[model samples]
Target: MDHHSSHFTQAFIHLDRLTHNMRLLQGLVGIRPLWPAIKANAYGHGAQIVGRHLVGLGYKTFCVAHVSEAIDLADAGLKATFIVLSATLPENSPYLVAYPCEPVVCTVEMVESLAGEAARTGKTISAHLKIDTGMGRVGIHPDAVADFLERCRNYPNVSIKGMMSHFPMADEADKSFSQQQIAQFHRTREVARSYGIRTFHFANSAAIFDLPDAHSDAVRPGISVYGLKPSHVMSNPQVDALQPVLEWKTRITFLKEVPAGTGLSYGHAFRTDRPSLIATIPLGYGDGMSRLLSNKLELLIGGVRCPQVGRICMDQCLVDVTALRGRVKLGDSVVIVGRQGREEITVDDLAQQLGTINYEIVTNIAGRVPRIPVGPSMAGASTESVGDDGTLKTLTER
Candidate 1:
């Protein structure tokens, strides 16, 4: 029954926070459909789990960055309308069409290929046309929007379900560039409507929280669904109340007393400043704990902050627990990226110390760390039964 004995670190996902965040997003973009972006394994919180939880919360649509991700969701029996936010090759078009997922058409060649395929199969292929409104990525040029729509308009099997664009500066507090992107999107949508094309969207997570006017018909919320703020620039009075859903944790495997001046971990980057009670945790860079966090990060042990005292190894790291006010022992719980009582350690906090972004912080966590989905079923209990092969099992089944 001791989950930590399995030698796997765990990322606990708070499903209630996920649902709450979606509701908050709905409140922000009233009546506009919210597509929870679950790309990159739902930002490393486990995609299938997050997707299923969101779908249960009445989310009708979900978005990912590639076709494979959509396939994964489909294989998991997700019945929501899934949208692939990136374009697919002509060869891959058939598979995309075959699967119950929609592709975001970004180029004329892709549009032509998909249209041709849909016509041949005698099935309506739903797609969203992506317009390049200054993101300078995969999207049709603004000037070519009309011609592109024209080519697909007569195609019998291709249905332009929606039109969308990415904002280059929507994360900024300064709304000038974001507003311009929105304006350009509106202009492009108007051009499409001149040809009688409606159902357009341009806002993403940033716009969903910061710019209400940018929410055209729907908003694709990526980061906010995980309960993190959109970006640092948008991290102001508006998003101060959002709760982070993902919690990175592990158990102390062993405790040892080290003499002062003892060299620790790789390259001797750290030496004990005094006689230290070091706790060795079975988590390291291989478990998605960043190598850059060595000696710079702190973990919450028994609700007390303990500094990482050595170079973060590939499979283990040492935390100095000498200053702890209470007795620390082996098998005690440790928190690397979540709240411990009134104290909290966040991906943003780690990113700030590591000089990276929150996205990289969570995504880089190695797959070895098993994500344990927590909800009302767990009743805030940290203990859960995981399989012998490191898969998490339901406690009731155990």
Candidate 2:
């Protein structure tokens, strides 16, 4: 059976490259336990798939954004420690205590509420205290951490296992600000230690690659584990040796020749300068292919880069295939974000075109598109089987 016969568009995940990328991260973090962040559905790579692969590799700990994401893992029978990066609202997200998850709490009320839930459930909760050193997004103020710690001391059921902070400028060229944040985290660590909190982690993807000193007892890496550098500032090829594992592809459903100067697509924004062959593939902004990329992005068909022309449609886009008019045809493969022969489209390339980051490019891929694993499975992983839509049918689902 033809592989492309299933879904018109697909995202192939290379597990071998994922393993390579993870090993590189392991080397960077040294002895610090690496908590690979799988929030945002493993950054749109399918958390269930990636999480299962990681579990087979002997990786026991993972992190997600909320209680739901962690529960999704548990429901799928993926037994691994999950660290929920976001704080839990005891009134709303009491499910955090129901499942074994480590939630990051910053405010005193959050700490108290969580303690109350722990007492109600007659269970002990292992939580992380988030301190705001500089990120300004969440976490308690450095000056007020002591007061927050004191509040937590009232509840013996709440176990503050980790104290952490986020760095906003860790990827910036100017290291001065990051240095200050690092110093602040170090001071916070000392205070937390006095209160019996010993686990400390501060390094994100950028810091893991740039700041070795910030790799305390545990380190968190989100983007780099998938093999893309967090920022261009850390893109020195020699040191950052990570391989991107995503390959977005679609199949040509229709092909037609147009007269020279013929207008095309939604707005007639593009006209054939010469007699051209237009190929329409099943990819659109609805699938997280940003409409901003209209008439600007390129696709790799037949191992040749073809320019996307005219206004992108909601369900499809047109690519000018005049260069290989006779060589291409309906049902041919087109690569939206991956290699085709010697030509390839990297997520960084897409990010540069949209004036965004590589993270958005990969994470924006819609969950509907089937993510078919394209590499060898780990020893204990389920043998992957594609459903009619090209998505992996879970071992139990089969």
Candidate 3:
């Protein structure tokens, strides 16, 4: 057995926190089946790991963006309902039939293709109809709901398991557009029910938090499970109780004293105003630390806030540590994306600084950062563990 040192930079995934967030969503949705979105590799948190953990915690359904993602979870022994939330292609039909995953049918052609494959295989194909109530990205139009359902109703091997739509702006404090979308969904549901279809769904993470009335049969919660709100306006009162599960961090690689006016990093974007001790951390845009954070973000070093001093490079960034009260040294840990004592750097904080959303902040973290599973010993464990080179290492060996 290889014994790696405890000083490697790694992402610390709080599994318990993930469960807690899921439970919180469940409590909020109240009896509406929770289909945790595991797409985009569980929002770059390792979909297989997060999916397995959630399945163990009694989450019976999962959502992904593609057929391959669904197959990955299935390969990971996820026996729960795996639904692909995007349109499927004809080329993917063979795998779709081979796997137990259900596809979200968005067009008449897709429905016919699935029906054909199911007939050939002598298997009942399960699918959810995506109704384009408002968001024009995917799904069949609401007006075509009756015709599409009627056309596919005669397919012997086709089973309509669900119906869903996406809300464009449920996160806004203004609910007028959201209400219109909901009304459209209701209209579509009525059309589907004319042919005896009952499984209806439309609320995503934002909708789940903002529009409780739209939790018809199930809720596909993506960001909320990771302990993030869809928008800042929707964060208070409704989703203030959610816990963030992913905590990003890295260790300080080395520390050096620079005289006043010393230019730091490439292009010399940052220059020392006064004599200062600059600590170089081994995570940059390559590891998902945004380049936009250059000189715009702060890292929690020893529970103290240290501002980034230069342009963030592909693999490293410099943080000013002169003002920090504690003794700064090489190999000391730094919290790039989580809490350190009373100093907490939230994704929202990063988003606000970077002029983006919390989703991009967390999901943009590069795949190289090893996500360490935080177990029951979470109380004593740092929100994140820092490695020697500042590359995140998993607490549990993968």
**Candidate with best lDDT:** 2
Q: How much lDDT does candidate 2 score?
A: 0.83
Per-residue alpha-carbon lDDT of candidate 1 for residues 224-303, written as tens digits (9 for 90 to 100)? 88888768778446576677989989999988888999999889899987888888998888888878778888999989
Screening candidate 2 with a backbone cut-off below 3 angstroms (N, C-alpha, C), the clashing residue pairs are: none
lDDT of 3 at 204: 88
Question: Considering lDDT, where higher is better, how would the candidates rank from best to worst?
Answer: 2, 1, 3
What's model 2's lDDT at 29?
Answer: 74
Those runs of model 2 whose alpha carbons end farther than 4 Å from true positions after fitting are 1-5, 235-239, 379-398
lDDT of 3 by residue, 51-101 (tens): 667767777788888988778668756677788888868778777877977
Please tell me which model should have the higher TM-score, number 1 or number 2. Answer: 2
Q: lDDT per residue, candidate 2, 1-398, as tens digits? A: 43432667887778898898888888877767888999887898877778888887778889899888888778778888888898667674378788878889887677677778889889888989898888988898888877778878998888999899999988888778988999988987887888888899899988888888799998999998888888878733534678988889999999998999999888799999998899989899877899999889999988999999988887899999999978998899999988899998999999999999999988888766767776776734444533434244643322
Residue 366 CA displacement from its true place in model 1, Å: 2.2
lDDT of each: 0.80, 0.83, 0.79
Deviation of model 1 at 214, angstroms: 0.8
Cα lDDT over the full model 1:
0.80
TM-score of each model, in listed order: 0.92, 0.94, 0.91
